[model samples]
Target: MKLLAVDDARARILAEIAALPAETVPLARSIGRVLAEDVAAVRDQPPFAASAMDGWAVRSADCPGSLKIVGESAAGHGFEGRVGAGEAVRIFTGAAVPAGCDAIVIQEDATREGETVLVPAIAAGRSVRPAAGDFKAGAVLLTRGTRIDPWRLSLAASAGRAEVSVGGRARVALLSTGEEIVQAPATPGPFQIYDSGSPALAEMVESWGGTAVRARPVRDELDAVIAALRDADAELIVTVGGASVGDHDLVRAAAVVLGLSLRVESVNVRPGKPTFFGVLGDGRRLLGLPGNPASAFVCAEMFLKPILSAYQGAPTAPATMPARLAEALPANGSREHWMRAKLTYADGGVSVRPYRDQDSSLISVFAASDALMRRMPGAQAAEAGTVVEVLPLSRA
Candidate 1:
């Protein structure tokens, strides 16, 4: 079978997916959720001309002169009467500016003697915040596809939105396979090791805004793999191990038995060439990842992250940036290479240093990497300080 380029494979996988349905969630709990609809302001921000500071509201023309102190205006309570000539109104921050008042004299700038106050000359509208200054009624402050953060939530709250419509979280089932693997906290046989990749992948799924359902480790038997796949109730199923064509690889064969239609047969990338994606008969998507810890991680960053983003109506491409290489590198082979690397920021620029050991099973090396340096297929040798594209690991 002809190997698909990494970009081609990603494109094919994304073509079959769409954003999940929208659901309403409280504004307080909408953080990290993608907006399903535009959020409009219910009313003008401030609602009225307000005082920006705790000061005296006065007419600019009456400043630098002693004036009669009028009624006070506190937050949620406004002075019913307007300020007339030779008069000032005591106000607090966020309070409505009294009618006929165009300037404010801070307490420090004036002296109060019972009902009479001495104020200094001040510019008009110096401390008065105009109504609708921040946003107007019916204005769209937050748009669809926006990811809500604390700052965005505050904006929505200011817009009088107690709840917001956001995309439903995508449920992903993580199935780890291999007869040579065992769950942690259980003593492993001499030939077996504790399963480490699924735990990290589950966290990565959550970080990428998906709900991960981790299944117990399945043996390398075809019936067990088939049973696990059939029982996974999720929109997307991620299988670790059993992706290669070796005799022990049973995921593809089991998927085939379950009516899988391949969308991506394989990718032309180092450490993840066996990665594949397909759609099952029941409409769930399946992504097959190599068992090696580094390989699964690299493939997850390249493919799984984007899939989750697409499911949430967010941008589907990895955000890659250019950085200078801290060490020289030999020419790349036919397949694209994504090398684990460390990044440093200095002199107003980013520098990346690829680890010397590029072995796919080295979990320690991958744990120490903060970025992935991309080397195109058939790329020529590069010297130190050469500019290269890098994808930052968010967890790092």
Candidate 2:
């Protein structure tokens, strides 16, 4: 295939991705997972009319006068008798108000005189919480595609849900193939270098809530590379390096030999032009990233993360904001430029400045950056203070 534009490639990948099936998980283990089904409240919150504080439950008309005290009502124990005329029931916070009582007189305003309690200025509905005030039974508490967080989890528990149906996590396999690539734990020879992109991709997979099933490092051999590609456990296979058209780039050659057709051969994006996307016969996804450290980072943020999120039924997209340019930028060339930059909090909004060393292999510069200023293809130059769209790398 010819080179694909960034948006076109992304749209194709999203259109082809298959969302995973759902599974039941206990509420305790559901945080950060996406809901596959709508969750309904099992029962009403504050199941009955209850008192909001330590006070007396009495008829709304019995305020500013003395009333005979009846049985007491504490949390988990409610008074059974009705609050008749000139009568009050001693109640504590969370205690259900007795029948015929529409209000609670705070204890601070009431003085006890043996069996009679003296009440002062009390308004109707004061210090009283009605049943279902927060949420009613059978109400939808959580909708499908909602990502569960601490606050949402608390709300689910309050809605009386012990278990929920959530989308299954995608199992991803990380593969790194090259003649000079050596495992990080082993010392590299003078001509060899440690394979850093594979491990970083594995961590990124885990951060996006996908399980990294395998991280295999292979030399530039067709058969061995084909064998590693057949790992059956992974729903998505991500290969770092061995994708460019150079003679030593053997991943695409082996994939073609194994009958995995390439869906996207290249993309018009900086630090990621050599990326390749394909699919295996068994319906698993195949994404080949450039071997350069920064290139791999950019492609993962642009492609891999979105595919994984689609599998999880995530409801939201990455955050973007308008940021002022701290310095002038030259007009972009044919490819989209994702300039790695630092964010400066300004009085009006954030400002961004690209790092000087933007080489695809510069890990130090990538580490120093917090955001990616997105410059479109062939865009015109802009002076400092120009507002541009920025995607924060931290959120990615």
Model 2 spans > 4 angstroms off:
49-120, 127-129, 179-195, 207-209, 313-319, 342-356, 364-370, 393-396
Error of 1 at 112 (Å): 3.9
The lDDT values for all models are: 0.92, 0.86
For model 2, give the 10-residue run with minimal summed lDDT.
312-321
Backbone clashes in model 1, listed as residue pairs: none
The candidate maximizing lDDT is 1
The digit string of per-residue lDDT tens for model 2 on 76-151 reads: 9999888899999999999998998999988998899999999986788999999999999999989998878879
C-alpha RMSD of each candidate structure in angstroms: 2.6, 3.7
Candidate 2 backbone collisions, by pair? none
> What is the C-alpha lDDT profile of model 1 across 1-396, one tens digit per residue?
669988989999999889998899899888778899999999999799999889899999987899998789999999999889999989999999999999878878889999989999899999889999999999999999888888999999999999999887899999999998899899999999989899999998987778999999999899999999999999999999999999999999999999999999999999899999999999999999999989999999999988988898875777899999998999999999999999999999999999999999999999999999999999999999999999998752
In terms of lDDT, model 2 sits at 0.86
Q: What TM-score does structure 1 among the candidates reach? A: 0.89
